[model samples]
Target: MRIRLQPLAASIAVAFAIPAVAQTPLRTLDEVVVEATRERDLPGAAAPTAGELERLRAATSDTASLLREQPGVSLYGAGGVSSLPVIHGLADDRLRIRLDGMDLIASCPNHMNPPLSYVDPSNLKSIKVYAGITPVSVGGDSIGGSIVAETRGPDFAQPGQGLLTKGEVGTYYRSNGDQRGINLSATVASENLSLSYSGALAKADNYKAGGEFKNFTATGRGNELARNEVGSSAYDTRNHTLGFALRGGNHLVELKLGYQDLPYQLYANQRMDMLDNEQKRANLRWLGQFDWGRAEARVYHEAVDHYMNFGMDKQLVYGTAVNGMPMYSRGRTTGVETKAEIDLADSSLLRLGALYQHYTLRDWWPPSGTGGMSPGTFENIADGSRDRAGLFGEWEKRFSPQWTTQLGLRYERVTTDAGDVHGYGNAMGNQLVDAAAFNAREHKKTDNNWDLTALARYAPSQAIDVEFGFAHKTRSPNLYERYTWSTWAMAAVMNNTVGDGNGYVGDPDLKAEKANTLSATFDWHAADRRWELKATPFYTRVTDYIDAVRLTNNAGFNVLRYTNQTARLFGLDLSGRMPLGNTALGQFAARGLVNYTNGKNLDTGDDLYNIMPLNTRLSLTHELGGWNNAVEMVAARAKNKVSDARNEVRTPGYALFNLRTSYTWRNIRVDAGVENLFDKLYYQPTGGTYTGQGTTMGINSIAPGIGVPGMGRTFYAGLNVRF
Candidate 1:
């Protein structure tokens, strides 16, 4: 019998760009290999193929938005382009994000430009997400698992063949926000050399909400009323990359240079917005294969300069003078990594690697008219630096045809230091207790951390497989978590990853966080590979988890201090797919996924901030000659268990429907979709507080407390052509 696999809406839209490859015959679970990691499959791992990535990119310009549908994944809204991904309730620096071969760091204090923002989705070739219990060889200094994104690699012509050229162009538009974007890429290749260039531009107006209207009272404008326009939610961005590659007998080397410019991006969850942002990056890599082993090495550098201020939407309420103060931050990262895979005894392999990184950061605010101190700068972090070095080894062995096992270990040394930091005092230039105490203490610290991983896979029958994994992971505190010296209102608000509108002061004496995770996966598949079902359950305990403690409750703001606490997290992920026999009308299929996670501060007996609520997605798909369509339903449970420390609010449960269809004609393809079909008004459980200053009359105002509102009904369409 021939097995037929159905493609979902996201994957079907890209079928025209690149035809899908034939699937290989099913093999025993012990023989399954993950192409991205070059290792056996791990529990709760998802890797989208190239075609699926292309289709997903056509729908949204934000890189993080692509992961929203994946199991065990949720998004923390910040700016239009800076949505942060959360896995099992861990976010931001708590997770290791690998872009291409480089470990990129967030440059902004507000984390405006995360690692994923560096690479546009239009240029991505593949993405792999390890939800929990990640392999030691692939990640370090993180407990939330790892995300790896790679751009299209060089493609060379066959030997004795002539020069080859390829190019693609695409454009998309969305109705709700009047958003528009364009992407272009071109490549030229010879037998020995290849060159490529890609670029993208995206812009959007403020998105509209889904409710009624209210007049503005803060601005004292009786004529002005907010019907549904979400305040401070507009953005404009551009990215460009140039790459070159050379191939020799058994070795290949590649070089890539990238530049990004974001002129303006409003943040709904922060007090300020990104005004000017720019980044420059360069990466050099070498890959070689020999009879004995395979070797890979990479060196990369990144420089970022960011500026933040008030946006036009917020100025209407606070006035331009009061919110005109501009904040500046600069960051630089230089890193190198080398790894080798060696052939050991039969059915066994060994892998070794080493990595080093040097990072520096500076955040300061120049004198401004509306500021407390004029003609003097407030240095949030001065000459802050962190250096890390790690070494790791892994061994994989097959004990028998039915069983496979792997073990890995890693050691990392981290050192961090910062120069004397200063804060803006009251008009008298007298320091507050938080700043005085922090400046009087030592500024240097070091940590020696270790990680361990053990995993095994057992296949008792062709249709049944079981996998178990255990991991011990460690992460040193980030510079912001250790070096922010001020307890002032503005300084206290900078130490945040959940976008909660609160102030925080860092504690330089905090210890590194360590985590232990245990996870298991069960997979059941048909003999012909037509359908599959997978279930995963995981538990984690963290010692010295970095959290916030309320220090003082001011009239308008609450001051928080960073502290360490014990935390626990438990979660389950379930996914399945089945094919309905083909009929004369078309081929039909059904697929669904459900995810649930609970996180708590074991020491404080409080719910963790920004924990995603239970959610599920179900879809029905239809395919015919050159046409594919899908209808999907998404549902989420209400979030009532709020975090008192962060003053988080509860959100009501909601359900939404979406419809998508795509058609392919030769080298040209068209995709169209309608999201939030019923125009339901809801809020995402993970979306943090609304910090945009606006009239208190509207439901989504800066005052009276409001969560980030979801976008209203939206219709989008796109076209792509390849030659």
Candidate 2:
């Protein structure tokens, strides 16, 4: 149904309202009347030129391809969908992902649940990404950054009358040779409740690499392909989610359940190839407000059953035929958290929270070669748990009506416990090393972190709101980085050595990492209401920064261990939106963004590895007669700075262009767009190379190395409707 408002009545109401004298009008006229929730905005230097939600929802290719237009993001993989996101030079577990209020952990060695694949863009209402200095509410020690995906919410109207249902379905076919996909989402909402669901299925054949690849061992001997061109195995994915919510005056309750299954081929980064990844999760939350305070409580549970194997039939293999050898693992996690906020006085608020989590890991390695039901060693079987609690408070006061200052402080304590586990060494050795005896006995410790923040804002004139902020934050190490013992994936192996294969192992006694952050932001609105701008500058100094370090040993294979080092980084971000006025062509607008970050490893006197290069985005959008059209251009410089003490790879930069248009008629909407218009052959400045080799080693011989080059041109179109 189409609803229309009385234009004459709106015009008359606006004309009778008193206008601000010598000041810019607010973006929305009734802004002051609406309750406001302060949202953490992206630091000026890491914001994307255009968001990925819409384009990604209708993507025909992989998640990485859909997001390539954004600055400082990169992907690398054999096929399209398998590529992962590299933000500010970090990917994998380094980046923290949050769905609503819970954390989703990926248990697959090959990273089956990258942030994009976990939540189909079609199901998202909005996504806010903070490259750094994310709010404390998100929790988790994130050295890289954070991505938050929020689902649609209930739409309530005038006390008792509300009905709404909306859904969208889309499919795309690509010419790149062998890939296709379908995506769908639907939602229904009433005054008291809402339901939403989304699903996506994708498939792709092997990819043709732009360079040659080598099949060999670490000793410089094995299969070799002069020119690298091969396709990946066929892979498929299915995901579904159901959510329910109840809302009353000051209390809200939400329940969410999610299921995901991906039966896929093994990639190069994995030790064993995965046959299936089944994941299940449940989440519950209750939030309530009281006369003097507010409280939020949450609980979450998740499980992962992963299946993998070793298969031999590749032409790159030297005259050999091997059957699949199956291996499997099961991972389970349960957590509960709660927080309370008290309104102490007119300008002060106290916050307190506590969290508890338990994790169990077990894996089985089936005996190989014979193929019969033979039981292999169950090398690792460990149970771990963590308990965390924190206290924080914020104080805000206005010196005058136009000036305000705020201060905040927080303290947290974390304790961990883990069972004993084996150590890392050559599994193929003729004799076993009693290395397990030397491994540090399992134990537990309590780590503490502190945060302090201060902010000052001044509205000298109604047209401008200037602000400045300073904060100091610290983070602890994660379980995986400090305790994982695994083999190298084929992709990482082939790329790390000219033919010398190797992999990484976990360290049990790793120390906690720490960082101190400082930042300032400015918001300005032109007196004429024709322009808006925002800028932020920040600097961070990290001591005992943790990293997966590759040992320089030249034995038969490579070995990696985790360690802590010192580092420093600084950057700037600027963005603006301007109105260009109506023309014979149409009503036009312009928006642009620029971001840059530079980092260095003080311990080794080298630049931080995988840092994104300086990048910028500009776009022109036009609107006329129910139609919206836009053209965007993006470009970035290559990151020449690199770590010399560790294995670090440098990525070259490139420029790209895209176009989008949409038409709306009543309850129907259509969107279409073309990406990488010029089909430029460029690479992400932070894209990772095959993981087997450290960065100091060259990747010229690795298959699909040089970090998968950016994809060629592609196009997509989709439709939405309400019923």
Candidate 3:
């Protein structure tokens, strides 16, 4: 398949040919929104709004991919839609993710679906990332930091206006995998009430690599001739949401409902593929403002039914006799949170909040002829449940015109348990050694977690600002890490987070992880704010860090057991932007960023698994009447230090280039881009192992030690209409 670039070029030419017209001045692209409270110099914080967000949304459909350029942020690929975000070397459950103030958890043991996957990029209005040493009031049960994604909210008509209606439609296409998508949103509003609806559909075929194949370990049979294509990397998805809101005086109420359907998705880092996925969610919120303070409350519920099995591509070589494993999982969560802010004095304010959550899960598999197992049902985790209650307080003080400080603390009580679990041997009236050993253990646990944060900011002059932060955070293990109840390879693999193509068993006696971190940020800006530079450095130490331990080699698969260890991480992030004086043709700007992180196991003296290599990005942007254009370069250092315990492989470093342009005319917008402009062949340091069927390039063909290949050169275009 080939994409014609002539038409895209013609479109750009036509946009430039239009006669110039008088228009309002456009906002400079270098301005950034500071989402943190009164103090704008908070360490390790970023909020990309307006034009920056629109440009990012046009680049990819995966929500997590949008964070790749943020300081200390990286992505761990799972499926086409499920790219997990990592902050400062920690990922998955270690980070707190909230969408529109609602906390969501992944139902799949493989983490095929995460909180960010629930919101399409087209629906997002803004995103805020809080890096290491996050504020206590903004984080809970997490150590890495927090991410908040807010969707488009209701808009009301002006007073004295009777009614208002508006809508938008958008479509995009990518040639790399023949990917295509469409989004629709509409709204109706009156003086006091509003209604809104949103819908999206997206699909893609397997993507191809930039070069020819090379056989590696675990690349599978008959895959040696895969050429440039990465098999089984496809997906189909659809989503819908409805919202309503009412306002009276200083009080407002809102409600929202959402639904998602994912019929099929392939996981290149997993042994099984997602055959079906369905989810539903509902949320309600209330906000009130009084002379002395403000109060807000929210309630939400989420549920998912997911299934996984062998794909046709894999069965062709492995066959039903050796493969054909099927599994099912169901998860439901309900929660409520309320917070209030009070005016204590002219220079001080106090914030308090309380939260409660209840969660339940079940995972199971049914015996079938394909595997030649006894006829029965095996319960991986049955009636697993977790409940949590928390309370927090925070205070912010402005000491003087040049100084500000904040302090916060939080406490949480968590309890977990599960009903008796059974394996196929029990259903077949036989005592399997693995099943008997697991069934004999207790399944109830409790934890008391606490969090603390302190930060201060000072602006010595208009051109210089300095900030410092410190935090102590705690997190308990998830249900899968405590209640998997089996030592079998198939059941154990479901509890893994690193996606290293290995099976894993859970440890019921695991302990909570506690992290202590200190970070600092320095900012320098021109008097007019046209040029700016920022740098942040951080260090963290973790007690009882969750890690994996090798168990046994069964059949052709390696199995691991979950355990706890001491760990440490340190990193630095630097960014800068500058604008050149405007010329007759247009305005120009330059921006760049560099990020690096190091992580190690304190007790074992080994490197952390899948740590990202040092990377940097630079871009030059130009703007004319109504058009914007940019050229970007991305480069990374070679990753030679690998984790021997996980059988990780080292990858050579490479550089790639990309081009993008956009134009707006009246109520219509057009965007076009070409990625991998140089067609460089490279590997993603954090793409996990190749579990897809067939043989490909790598060191270990039977189990492949090489990382997944990066996508080849591709062209993309998008159109949006709004009124």
Task: Please name the candidate that would achieve the greatest TM-score relative to the true structure.
Answer: 1
Where's the lowest-lDDT run of ten residues in candidate 3?
Answer: 13-22
lDDT of 2: 0.53
The per-prediction tally of clashing pairs is 3, 17, 18
Work out the TM-score per prediction. Answer: 0.91, 0.79, 0.90
- Candidate ordering by TM-score (highest first): 1, 3, 2
lDDT string for model 2 (514-574, tens) is 6666665555667654576766667778788765466544323345566788888887766
lDDT (10s digit) by residue, model 1, range 1-723: 001111111121110011111121111111111121222122222333333445567678888887776767788887877799888788888888888778888877778889988777777765656775677777799988777767767878887879979888999999988989999999899988999999999999878766632333232332332656667788999999998999888788899999999899988777777898999999999888789778889999999999987676654333444435678999999999999878675767787999999999998887664546454677888999999999999877677766777788999999999888666545432345655677788999999999998887777776766778889999999888888766655455655556777777788999999999998777776755467777778899999999888877543347688899999999888777778879999999887889899999999999988888999999898989988888999999999877788788688999999999888788888889988999988887888886655542122234634777888899999888889
Which stretches in model 1 have alpha-carbon errors above 4 Å? 1-51, 212-225, 316-323, 425-433, 554-557, 695-701
Give the distance in Å from residue 218's predicted Cα in candidate 2 to where it truly belongs.
18
Residue 224 local lDDT, model 2:
27
Deviation (Å) of 404 in candidate 1: 0.9
State the local distance difference test value for candidate 3: 0.75
lDDT of 3 by residue, 598-692 (tens): 99999889899888999999989898987989999999999877776777767889899999999878788888999999777888888887666
Q: Model 3, residue 563: displacement in angstroms?
A: 0.7
Q: Which ten residues in a row have the lowest lDDT in candidate 1?
A: 1-10
